[model samples]
Target chain A: MGSYNWNWPILLKEPYFGWIVSGFGKTILIAVFAWAIAFPLGSAIGIARTADNRALRLAGTVYVDIFRNIPLLVQMFLWYFVVPELLPADWGRWVKRDMPYPQFITAVACLGLYTASRVGEQVRSGIEAIPRGQRDAGLAMGLTPTQVYRYVLIPVAYRTIIPPLTSDFLGVFKNSSLALTIGVLELTSQARQIEEYTFAAFEAFTVATVLYCLVTGLVIVIMRIVESRTRIAGTIAVGAQ
Target chain B: MFGSFDFGILLANAPFLWNGMLLTLQLTALAVTGGLLLGVVLAVLRLSPIKPLAWVVEAYVNFLRSMPLILVIFWFYTLVPKLIGRPVSGFYSVLIAFVMFEAAYYSEIIRAGISSVRRGQISAAMALGLTKMQSMRYVILPQAVRNMVPVLLTQSIVMLQDTSLVYVVGLRDFLTSADIVASRDNRPTELYMFVAIVFLVICFSASRLANQLRRRYSL
Candidate 1:
């Protein structure tokens, strides 16, 4: 067997180090893009699930089911490769030409849709967790259904669902690495690239893993703070010490 | 335009897709079994009498839970073989990675189920001349396992979907095979629609199965 020289210090020099730093930036960018899109869409789908109209509820339910069940990678491929082809020729050409960031867009859409399903479920459960009398009281006061939901149901439900929503957000952040398969140069993808260049697999991935843990840990801390502040007084206690 | 939906292309690729489907099922089954075994061990560790052991298990679960499964998959694919001075097969690496990652998650679910078992039951078991292990094995485990049916099923379904990430390591799972066919045929839309439909069917069935289990067990 041939012995190969492995130099960790040299690997961290100049351009190599810059790439790792930029990779971190790209990861944060991907996570932010996905979360920003997913949160509101999830909230809407969640609200729709609780509507009076059965058809709307059904539509929302089906949407959530389809997205939640399929893998994000499959969905990203569909959005990037498949959906573009289905468009009209000029539009398809435009998408192929103008959309340099198809991978990023697809990542955001996939994460958003996937996270929305889980968030929708959380939202539904949160709303259900709130006592029915609150809605009834809102109705007695002559508030419209939208007003009741907007002013009463949603705020309370949002508060209750914050913890789960935080976890979902963290999941989105982690899952954004799937974008690499589609050519987005996020953290994992960049790490893979570095490993290919230098064959320093451990150093590359260990750094990536630590960065992921840092981001997710920050999310957990923020969620705990939110959970503490918004907790309904004496209603439910947090189980984790 | 790809000249409308082509049932012909789909029919032509059905056999290949079937092969891919079989592989997907194989990977999912293997990974789910591995996950369950690892999950059970970690669950026990998390509930161990020793505080340090519990803390270590908690950290493992937290780290695995936080890290993306794709990263874990990549880590196994790249680092494990390199670290061990051998090249591991992509399929086995993926399986191992899934097991390690999902175990942490499922362990938490199992731990939750175990903890949810009333304290009285354990005390009663102890009072009946049973050792701690015996009490856990007989009284706590049965109820915990029963209560965990729904969550365990859901986790399995999620794992099934997550198997698609194996494509990153160049594994020819369902999604990868479909990608190849799509790229080769230059009909990404039709091919992906087919892929999506396949995923939808599998996931929906799994979820339905989970619901059935939940109903049957009344967990």
Candidate 2:
């Protein structure tokens, strides 16, 4: 029988603490950068899907469907392996050899683009839920279609979808762990490394599990605040996904 | 760059990929069925009037939902054999992990579906001398399941995508098959492209079907 030599202080000590804390930092960094890209990219695609032109709508739909349906892990590998090779030879060489932190770049891009598809879906649905008359009124008031969306459609849609958006934000945070599959040294990977080093498989993951719950729990609280503060009066009933 | 795109290599590996695809589909089916049933129970318990029990359910869902799927996969891959006193296969470990992990997401969908049913309907069922469980079974659940099917299926798409994670435990699902072939043949681009397309086609069609079902069933 194996002896149960549990040391809670292992997490408080040198290499383990640094590994986990930095891993947490990386997870947040990847999620934040990804969301930064996803938000604008998604809004553009969302607007495109809601456009009157068929080609634009179709383009948006195709982008969302292709990216959303493909698994993130597959897409991650595609970005890491295939996308580089498909670039021009010199550029491909740079990505493969010379570029700094290519894995991180690929992880961020894959997660950002993948998440944009989902955010676009939510954005489109949120915009569609707005009354058609609002668009008409903005047009009647001498607003361009773009201006109408920018001024009239977007603000309300964003407010309405805050709850769903919160969940998606949480989704991105969780998904960032997938980056470790491509050698990003994010939280999950660091936990695995710790387990390998200390031979305390359970302890390493226990710390990680607690850290995840804490971060997610904090995000929920902050998002709840945002949801309430920005909520339109009597419009969006609070809901869970 | 794509001008010289090679289908010949990918076509030659179709049978190899198919084996993995089948495993992926099998994992999805098993996980979805087990998860959905378990999720329904969790949802009911979450919504039950028993405060302590509801809190316990809430904690379970919250804790699991917060953690990443890969972490859960790792935990189960190592932890299960310890609990059972015998080593289990990668396939069994992954299946059990996926079902438990997916149940959290499915529970929320089911809970939302249940709450979407009008309160008046439940009251009316009770007025007709139906017990709470009986009313939920005969009246509420039928409607909830109908409304929830589309969302459930949408989550199934996510699960199907997630089955690729079983590759980490060396369970040779679709992505892993493509991976094995790619590493062996040094045709990573072609094989990955092929696998990605297969995933895209299946998930896209399934999503369309879900939308159709949503329109047909949603009240």
lDDT of each: 0.84, 0.90
RMSD of each: 2.3, 1.7
Name the regions of candidate 2 deviating beyond 4 angstroms.
A1-4, B2-4
* Model 2: per-residue Cα lDDT over A63-138, one tens digit each: 9999989999999999998998889999989889988888898899999999898899989998998999999999
lDDT of 1 at A208: 90
User: What DockQ do you compute for every candidate structure?
Assistant: 0.69, 0.78
DockQ of 1: 0.69
lDDT of 1 by residue, A46-134 (tens): 88898899998998899888988887888888877777777788887888888767677777887777888888888887888789999
* Residue A146 displacement in candidate 2 (angstroms): 2.2
Give the TM-score of each candidate. Answer: 0.94, 0.96
Q: Any residue pairs clashing in model 2, and if so which?
A: none
For lDDT, the strongest prediction is 2
